[model samples]
Target: MLDQLCHILLLVVVSILYHVTFFLPPSWVSVLRISVLLLCAAKPVSVMFTELFGRFRPMPGEGTEGAGKVIGYLERLILVILMVVGEYGVIGWIIAAKTFARSRQLADSQAFCEYFLVGTLLSILSSISLYLVLYRW
Candidate 1:
């Protein structure tokens, strides 16, 4: 319960940062919002709750097979985040440069940097959450 609340609050903070920083198209923004919200609120909460109810693995036991799989899923998000960062940091600037050829009002570098920052913040938040979730120490 406490964990869920913490995650929700973090998600809210991340959402605000994303909106204030990125200039994503409405369609992409909506999709990104839903994806982040679902993972932050629903996925981890469900994992913890289910573990509480069904079965929990001992710290060093053979019965904890699913633990590795769950952890792998969480860890892979970091790789995805790295890709997102590269895209926002580099590809975004390229696009902005191209768009600038037509419209002089767009601040491609600023937009890219903002998106990169937001992505970094989110990845950090999620990674911290994962550490908390996976490690009891």
Candidate 2:
């Protein structure tokens, strides 16, 4: 209980410092908000996908769980940042770059490709929806 309280206190302090130090515009504020939301949602989303993909469309090899979760969180953060800055084109490039990097591995495995695509799509959709909700431009 004490550890949890300290951790929560630390998180609050850090979040306050981050907001105070950053010179974010209104839309960028939404980005920050969405990033936090994504961070919290990452694990639940991963579990949901694990059930959907792992059961229905199982990939052959086991992935590094922590790394994948961190990567997805970072990916959502980047997408939110890009959207807030109106760099919609960069989002496509980001996706393309990911595809290029994974092309060789994905080429040999349809199940892996499906898993990757579904996760990417979910991240993109969540980022876009958050942006639209906050800054309906």
Candidate 3:
């Protein structure tokens, strides 16, 4: 319970800091906002993801857990860029590519399918939430 509270507090603080960036000079706003967004995604969002779904163990030979973290980072970065550019439709291509890459695991293991779906949805939600917080000011 304490851990969950900390995670929620971290997100709220990050969201507030991200919004604060909007008040900076125009040139600094983009750089600062993206930096903060990426930073938040890197650690806090990962913790949130783990808290929500870490119980689902990966299948044997599924690859290193580090790789998943890297993928999640890249996924969130791409999503934030797409959202910033108003290319929401292209977001589907990212999902398609991930699905294609993991087609085998997705097909063979029900556990992996649920894990993948949950992780992907969480990643998308985090990215969109960060984007909205950063720009909605």
Q: Judging by TM-score against the true structure, name the best candidate.
A: 3
lDDT of 1 by residue, 20-136 (tens): 646767777656654564465335643544454334322333334565345334433543344344443543454344345424322434543443344334434554454344222
Candidate 2, run of 10 with poorest lDDT: 36-45
Q: What is the lDDT of residue 98 in candidate 3?
A: 97
lDDT of each: 0.47, 0.70, 0.83
Q: 37 in model 3: Cα distance from truth in Å? A: 1.6
Note the residue pairs that clash in candidate 3: none
Q: Estimate the TM-score of every prediction.
A: 0.30, 0.63, 0.78
Error of 1 at 63 (Å): 6.9
Query: Per-residue lDDT of 66-127 in model 3, one digit per residue for the tens?
Result: 78878998998889888888999999999999999999989998988888898999999999
What is the clash count for each candidate, in the order shown?
A: 0, 0, 0
> Which sections of candidate 3 miss by over 4 Å?
1-23
lDDT of 2: 0.70
Off by over 4 Å in 2: 1-48, 51-54, 60-65
For candidate 1, the C-alpha RMSD (Å) to the true structure equals: 19.4
Best by lDDT: 3
Candidate 3 RMSD to the correct structure: 3.8
